[model samples]
Target: MSTTTHETRIDVDPDVPLVRITREFDAPPAKVFRAHTDPELVARWLGPRGLEMSIDHYDCRTGGSYRYVHRRGDEEYGFHGSFHEVRPDELIVQTFTFEGEPDGVALEKLVLEDLGDGRTRLTSTSLVDSFAARDAFVASGMEVGVREGYERLDEVLAQG
Candidate 1:
């Protein structure tokens, strides 16, 4: 049996160029971590609803890089990044770049903490170069995409 929850908490620090997101899943750490690192599972639940996602290449490991695109109708959004570190079922550190603003790159770190009883808590922090860049990312409707994507992930988890 599995469960579903939609309690994603997002915080943007005013004093620093950072964004933090915390969410809980009704699954173990390894399962959630695999969902994040596996390209096939990532394509199933890593973006907003109604967008077709295509992965150019996704190598999730230390020193590995990934590039993917999401398309809705004629519009296409591309993102690429490199994995700086990977700790199975525990942590991932990576660089994130949106193709639209090539210069506004962010370093992201995600940590998964097991809550016991088949649940995991995911804490994600993104640090950008400037407050303006962080604000821009916050203003880009990222919350919607994030929340919906996690909701979809919850559903996917429920299936297992």
Candidate 2:
């Protein structure tokens, strides 16, 4: 058995209104892609651990749309997005919007790279409309969610 640990790296562009995230997974690209496209698998590992996620609708194909809600105690947060392009186990392009800040829509692209040995690297970039918007996103404690979510995903992938 191989014992390897992966960490998530988030980079905020100082000049451009973009944020880039990179993480490695022990599973292959296809498996990692499935975890992202499948709503059930996504809900299992998509956010911070304490929140309960409920998907209103999750259509991951090209031109498909999705809406999901995360609830923590008495607070509920909603997010919706439209998939612009989807390529199985390779790429995904989408628009993301948080209900709280409807004006701050972001265009995101995710790419999965095969690292051989049953491992994969996932890189995602989110481009917001303005630097303020990007800064706000980074300040929102998204790193916690990203790190914890990937950790959960590692467990999910290991179960197979």
Query: lDDT of each structure?
Result: 0.94, 0.94
Q: How accurate is candidate 1 locally (lDDT)?
A: 0.94
Note each model's CA RMSD in angstroms.
1.2, 1.5
Query: What TM-score does model 2 achieve against the real structure?
Result: 0.96
**Residue 87 lDDT (model 2):** 100
The residue-by-residue lDDT of candidate 2 on 86-147, one tens digit each, is 99999999999999998889999999999999999999999999998899999999999989
| Candidate whose TM-score is highest | 1
lDDT of 2: 0.94
lDDT of 1 by residue, 48-148 (tens): 99999999999999999999999999999999999999999999999999999999899999999999999999999999999989999999999999999
TM-score of 1: 0.97
Pairs in steric clash, model 2: none
Per-candidate TM-score against the hidden true structure? 0.97, 0.96
